[model samples]
Target: MTVNNIAATFLLGGIALSTQAQADFLRDGKATLGLKNFYFNNDSREGAAKPSKTEEWAQGFMLDYKSGYTDGVFGFGVDALGLLGVTLDGGKGRSVGSTMIPVGSDDRPVSQWGRLGLTGKVKVSRTELRYGTLLPRLPVLVANDGRLLPQTFEGGQVVSRELANVTFNGGRIEHATGRGSTDRTGLAAVGGQRESNQFNFAGADWRVSRDLLAQYYYGHLEDYYSQQFFGLVHTLEFSNDQSLKTDLRYFRTESSGKNSSGAAGYRISGYTKEGDGEIDNRTWSAAFIYSIGSHGVTAGYQSVSDGSNFTQLNQGGLEGKGAGGASLYLYTDRLTQSFTRAGERTAFGQYAYDFTALGVPGLKASMMYLRGDNIKTVSGDRLKEWERDFSLDYVVQSGALKGVGLGWRNGKSHSQAARNQDQNRVFLSYSIALF
Candidate 1:
């Protein structure tokens, strides 16, 4: 072990101390069970033939249990998550595929695939330490939560919120067993073929004021890649129900470990600078949103350098997962990457509104469009493409049958660089509390 490993171990101990410093006492917890009905369809915009059956159905349950620590200088707690997914319908002929449930032989959707996760934690003043399981969303690394159930990791985390309005988080993840796959694997670059066993990260986010926030993050994966990121977010309020929101993001990354040692990561094989392979990249995005009463509009632009594409904490590729809706978080940039090429730029816009302005208390809708260009592939091909997304949603606001929500989403894409995808989705969810 190196000095860094020793420091990480100490950090983990500190997390345990923050919570365990207090006296012992029983804590309170709550449990909720929700039922969701969903549907997904995708048409192949590219390929020799027309799109076929790409749809599926299932019933799922989520159970959560959390324990609080006793009052004192230190405390301890435990948490557990129980998940169950059952295939209500869908055969080989109609199965679209998904991560929550696996597909069987002949491309048939499975009857079910469920797993449980448990965690142990300790807390001290303004800081907490946890081990066992993790589902994270950070700048350099985060869990994917786009599917029916979120992907999870196994490791330890140290988080501190001691400063007023400023939070610091750091961790060393030793093992990652993907939620979608039954196997556990080491860390690897999105485009690299080699694997690694450790991923180290430290980050901070600060709310400078009521309208402004800033973030700084750094991450290093053993024998893989290293990255640095900075971001600024602000929300400006204007006239009646009108506001302007802005987000500025930037990243600097390069090959590392074995890549730096030669023949690893996305670095060109057998090519080394002073006996070390190297792949450097820089990317940034800026977005602005304006909202007035019932109408909201947004515009954004993102660009990626030609050296190497941006990377994400992907467990299992989304191939098996059926796509039906646009994800709001975690996996934000899906437009351009290594597999799709590089030196890319994307411009996008959205318009949305609330139905309450027209007397419909529980309804809303939005539409978005994105176009990407200047994509450079390894074969020296420049590719261009675009996509449009539309979504509508409503929730019950009153009466005995309140708290139910329904959603519809439609998307279309076209490209000269890769396979085009046309998709649609339907989702219905209800939340019930048993007190």
Candidate 2:
């Protein structure tokens, strides 16, 4: 069915329920509205060939509504989301690409744009089945929310937690809408042209102990590749309000279907073997963090095999379809570079502090640095890169403006194989609850 038809059916079904169902829905319904004022700027240190910088300012509004399940052994619920973005300041030269706003035919940012999403759900005991819109955060698939609006998916999902300390998830995603655009596009790997309509995933999380957790997940993109992930997390407490945390993650992936032999022009964009484009890779990382009071220190290392760059659902090649940006599920995925090139190894460290420990609440600051080397480029050259980032955030602690937030971020990246760049962002946000 068409998207419009599906939306209409969900709405009509809710309205046609019994009077008792309607009363319960209204009684348990909840709504919220959020406001965000954002400014983004990026400076490319490359030669005059590229634009010197990109700067834009915009405002966004988000309205969310969730209704309670109707009365019965098997209950039903409905959820809706409304998103709107207004261009406050952006010129043709500054908005050449669709970085934070959709670009029009004239190669300029549009004045405004918006979209609506709806989800229908049914629940029994501790399990729920949902259809339509989704913002999923599983081990294998995470929704992107770095721009003015969040990326959403069209899919059906089932989540169950019938067993104590264990949760299971399964889903099939068909399409995705970019964070900066209003159009929905099929899924593909980064730099790939062919679009695939099927992205199936399943996963489970088990809390082995109060301070330890384990996870396993699998994902398959038809005509592309399949992947498996395993993760473990543990925390230990010490005296004097000090604690240590450890995180380990691993992923194994291989080509499937058309990508196995590179038929129908189904080839990944990055470095691959000479014969045919195939996915063969193993990536892993381990991180350790120590905290004392409100201060945290973290250290981590990550490695990617020599076969291919780590693969993930990316739509960057679909720029003509209004989808340009993508994100990876790795700590090395930073503001500038992902550090996932073939045969790459990365070491990173971070320091963070919360002002609450110093008698000032609602204020936080952090700094991070990463260095990567031994990258295998398509030209058969070894490359290296490094990045440094800093951020500060503050939120209103009390009074009428409580919960209002202000944030600032700065980053610098230098690479031997790519252009060097500096980026900055400033944003203000506020949220209000509505019945």
Candidate 3:
């Protein structure tokens, strides 16, 4: 059945529940409206591309409503999401490839666009089952939210926390809607042109101790690839505000189904060891962070095996214009680039401070730098690249503007393997609660 039909069915079921059950559901519900104004700009320094620059301004709205589960052995609930985007400005010839704004057949930014989503859920004991629109943050599948509206998936997922210190998750995803587009499309890897309708994943996180946690996840994309991930996080506290955190992650991926058979449409993109599109990679990274009072410092290193670029569920190769944005659970997934090229090694560092310590509440700043070298190329050449990013944020803590947020981000990248560029983004946001 369609998602709308399912939502209507759930609503009808709720209407037939006992009066006390209905009261519990209505009493615990919540609703909110979020507003965001964003501006984006990018300048390409060393590319022959048509649009050497892209600049745009837009406004976004998100209306969210979530109902509580009824009081019963098996309770039911529903969630609805509404998203709308309005274009405030689009620099005529400079807005061609703006991934955050939707374009029309005239190759111009659209005046407005929007979409709606609904999810129906059920709960029993410590386990819950949800179907329809979902924004998952699992190790294997993370929903991207770097643009005006978040990328969403249509699927069913189950989460269980019945066992102490452990949480289990399993899901099957069928479709995805890109952040900048209103239409939904099938799933695919970064470079694959054809669609893979079935993506299955399962994972678990175990709290081994008060200071350490362990995680394992497995994912399979039919006719594409299969991947496994292992992670560990530990924190050592020296005092209340002084501590050290260690994070380690590893991923193993291999070609499967049509990809393994060397099919034409299922091949991945980017540099591969054998110049073939088949996926085979092992990636690992380690990071350490130290914090004392309001200051924080982080250092990390990452290495990608010599087979192919690290594989992930990226739909950038699809036929649509805005179907090209993805996120990775890696420290090197920075603002302008993701250091995941084949045979690449990256080292990165960052420093941050909380301004509240200086008597300026609700303000913070951070800067980060990353250098990557030994990137594989089809011409048998190694390349190097570097990036620096800066961010500043503030929130109103008093008066009529309390809870309003403002942020600015800037980054510069120089690369031997890709274009050299500079980018900036400014955003303002606020949320209003409705009972």
Among the numbered candidates, top lDDT falls to: 3
Q: Locate the minimum summed-lDDT window of 10 residues in model 1.
A: 323-332
User: lDDT at 48 for candidate 1?
Assistant: 67
Residue range 1-435, candidate 2, lDDT tens digits: 864457557667767789998788778999999999999998888867556788999999999999888878777888899999999998888874548888898988999988999888888999998888889988678888877888888888999999999999998999988888898899988777888999999999999999999999999999989999999999998967799999999999899988987875567877765535677789999999999999999999999997888998887776487777777778888877888888889999999999997888999999999999988777764789999999999999999989999999899999976679999999999999999
Name the runs in model 2 displaced over 4 angstroms.
47-49
Task: Compose the digit string of candidate 3's lDDT tens values, residues 1-435.
Answer: 876678767877877899988987788899999999998888988889868888889999999999999999999888899999999998567675327888887789899999899898899999999888999997788888877788888888999999999999998999888888887889999989999989999999999999999999999999999999999999999999999999999999999999998798899988887777989999999999999999999999999998999988988888764677787888888788999999999999999999998899999999999999999867655799999999999999999999999999999999988899899999999999987
lDDT of 1 by residue, 365-430 (tens): 988888878776544446788888788999999988799889888877787765677777777878
The candidate that wins on TM-score is: 3
User: Cα lDDT of all candidates, in order?
Assistant: 0.66, 0.87, 0.90
Residue pairs in clash, model 3: none
C-alpha TM-score for every candidate: 0.83, 0.97, 0.98
Give the clashing residue pairs of candidate 2, or none. Answer: none
**Candidate 1 — which residues are off by over 4 angstroms?**
1-27, 48-53, 93-100, 105-107, 177-179, 182-184, 191-194, 261-279, 317-341
Pairs that clash in candidate 1: 18-123, 18-124, 19-75, 19-123, 19-124, 21-74, 22-73, 22-74
**What overall lDDT, based on C-alpha atoms, would model 3 receive against the true structure?**
0.90
C-alpha-based local distance difference test score of model 1: 0.66
